[model samples]
Target: METLVKLFKNNIRQYGMIIALVVIMILFEMITGGLLLKPINITNLILQNSYILVLAIGMVLVIITGHIDLSVGSIAAFVGAVAAIMMVDLHWHPVVAVIASLVVGALIGAWQGFWVAYVKIPAFIVTLAGMLLFRGLTMIVLKGQSIAPFPNGFQKISSGFIPDFGSAGTNIVAVLAGILFTVIYIVNELRDRRAQKKYNFEVVSGGLFILKLVVIAAIINAFTFMLAIYAGLPNILILLLVLIIIYSFVMNKTVMGRHIYALGGNEKAADLSGVKTKKVTFWVFVNMGVLAAISGLIFAARLNAATPRAGTNFELDAIAASFIGGASATGGIGTVFGAIIGGLVMGVLNNGMSLIGLGVDWQQGIKGLVLLAAVAFDIYNKKKVTFLK
Candidate 1:
């Protein structure tokens, strides 16, 4: 009983945001008259939120490193414009255009990183200037007009669905993927538990572990089944999954990842310990630029156009997602999965409210409240922990 209690408390502290997400989803699902989880709506939700998820992934890293980038929205807009020009007007190959856009993104990152990391300019000021500069450049690039109707190849990046090879009315690929994911998840959990035990670290009891596995498996299979029924997997979904897996591994298992956390936790102490704070900070922004660019391409492809106002306020969305996902504003705290959950929380709220005929004004107001509550919760938890210690 004591072990179970301890496990529950630990899991709550670590996964409270995820639990809140699930609860909010269920509430919205009920309020939406069963429309929230319909197969088509589920697909729409994933597509609509894919670009934000991309940005959130990168933003979490920035927050984890104890900095902020207010220019991501502008950068995304600029990159999208560049892509549109390269592919539409210049007639560059889709593949080559993508490469060029990514290169542009990296250069943008390096530019801001130079100011932030090397020149010792505050990130807030640098990114603020970048926001204005890039937004202006986007307008100039597009000449205050929208570019449209990208090639089919480019559109497919955001709108394509996976081929279905299953029997009529079923998606065999999705089911298989779900099963594989469940197995991998269980195996990883068990392996982690064994490793922790070997190192004499605390671990949940066997029964609790089994329960956790079962619950997660059910959720995974259910989500996959919903997707299978609608249109199988989306191309953007695949991209999001790959990124989540790769970044999760990087953040949780890599030496660079640990160093980033250390840097965020205490910059001066990290420097004293021989951590290259400047290089890490520089690379972190560079990575953020690349992600913002990828998001730009995805967004432009989804809209089939690049407008001057493309990516307006996207930085706010990404930042909110990070904080809602349990990323500490003080840095050195967050997870890739948490960011995904945070994005989903916001996505579902938007979808559900829209379905129920809520106006955009109300939606924005509600979202603002939710963001405040999440940050307040984080601060409360931190204070409680400190008091207890």
Candidate 2:
């Protein structure tokens, strides 16, 4: 039936990334002799990718505002160095060092934000200069040395997991969290359907909606199960989940989120409609900077050290993730979930290749090819959709 064909076509756009994730996971499992999805490896995959996923949240917002931030990696490294200097050299408490690092990162964002917003400079140039400056700062702060032996609590920032507080045979926290996720998914989808009906718009059919609920429930519970096997889910993983939920809510439910899309969709017109273009631009960069800093802390905590070279090339991974997740290079099109998934794709490829004992050269070559192909696919998909419309 024509209705079935049309439904399938529409659903494809919304579900393509999920489909791709499933397909790639299966293919990689086969390639790795079924090791890719092993419970331990799956848990590790999320842990290792958590930092980039955090950065991608900010990067997607930056890309949405029609700009780029090449300084995130450098900023991350610089922040880590700052924290290390505070904790190691100054003998400051680890908690104080963490807070100071985040504050420093926020101020760094404010600095770049000022240049891009008030000074009317293109983001590319400002962030590029920032990239060099921050990297140099990191080197100077670290004195070209790696610093380690952070306090146990500091290491726990990334390495620790929520302690189980339930029955001996059952992990209560994971079970409760899984239940919450299922409830939230169902409520959110129902709300979306109601809103669409109220607005006289076409909504996805009930069958498809139920299918989505089932798929989401399965994935969330499955992830929770894996975490229970590991150290019961990392603190960093919990942070990532909180961010994903909060930002996903912002992007979907808030007026500010709509403003971002509007500005991206058409900057000139949005300005004409009274959107404070400069404020939005400044805030986006500031937020990006703050996130870069947090990501830096996570990266440092994971390694339990700080180095001038930490987070090198991380900006590349974040950008590639955004592009692959369906963000147009020119801006005005992207999603938070899309960017996260994009990061995972890159993370998985890197992790899986390393597991299989692939050399760095081959990893770089293949990843570069994957990035190129992903960008090309984004372009092709847009063109196809436009033609269909």
Candidate 3:
């Protein structure tokens, strides 16, 4: 019993958000008469949460380093406007428009990064100013109007799905790809476990490992199966998948990842240890900016147009998701998966509430309480650990 308790205590930080996710799913599932997990709604939940999940992954890194970006929502809105104007108003090709928007976003990130990392400005002030400045720029670019009905090819970025085996031209290819992905995932997990064992580190039990594999396989099959059901996997889904994999790799398996953890753990000590603190901080913001641009493009393509208010309140959702996913408000802690789960929880709440006809007011109230509870938990846990030590 004592061993079990210690194990639970050790994993609480990592698994706490997951527990919250399960609890939220169960609660909303019961309240909504099972609408939360209904097939169509479940699919929609994934789609709605996808962008924020992407943002949260990047945000996790930024927060871990003890900073925040408030301008992402505004940047997304502005970039979407730019893409729309370039495609519709200027007759630029969708491809070119995308490239242009991304460059602009990177530049925006660099600009802010310079201010924060070099000029020694507080993140809150810089980002707060950025929020207002970029939002106003979006209005100027969009002329207080929404532009849409983009070229079909661009529209497909958001609305198009991958073709599957059932389709005349694409089913076999997709099936093979899915199988390959499963194999790769299993191999990687087993390899990582072996490495941990080599270093005499305590890996999770093989039983737990197999359980994870089974659960992952089921999830992948279910996901691909749904795409195969209606319009195969989306082109954007593929893009998002590639991005997630790349970012996850960079975060977990690179020197860049090490630097980020070092900075988050202790900025001054990290600087003294030659981690290039300013450069890392600058790059982190730049990365966030690029991600915001990518998010804007995806959203715009999906809508087949651009709206002036495309990303309003998005920053709030992303920030909340990170915090709820177990990121410390004071920084030095967070993870990609945690942020994803956090975003999904919010998505579920929105979808479930909407499906069950819960008023928007109540939904907001519940979310507020949930956020408060999460932060309170963080503080209480910190205090408990300090006392224990």
Runs in model 2 lying further than 4 Å from the true structure:
1-14, 166-170, 385-389
For candidate 1, what is the lDDT?
0.92
Regions of model 3 farther than 4 Å from truth? 1-8, 167-178
Q: Tell me the whole-model lDDT of each prediction, alpha carbons only.
A: 0.92, 0.85, 0.81
In model 3, what lDDT does residue 185 have? 87
Please write out the lDDT profile of model 1 over residues 89-138, one tens digit for every residue. Answer: 99999999999999999999999999999999999999999999999999
lDDT of 2 by residue, 232-259 (tens): 6668878998999898888878988888
The TM-score obtained by model 1 is: 0.97
Q: Estimate, for each residue in 286-310, the C-alpha lDDT of model 3 and write its tens digit.
A: 9999998988887787677688788
- lDDT assessment of candidate 2: 0.85
As a whole number from 0 to 100, the lDDT of residue 360 in candidate 1 is: 96
Separate clash counts for every candidate:
0, 0, 6
**Which whole-number lDDT from 0 to 100 does residue 293 have in model 3?**
92
Clashes of 1: 0
* Candidate with the greatest TM-score versus the true structure: 1
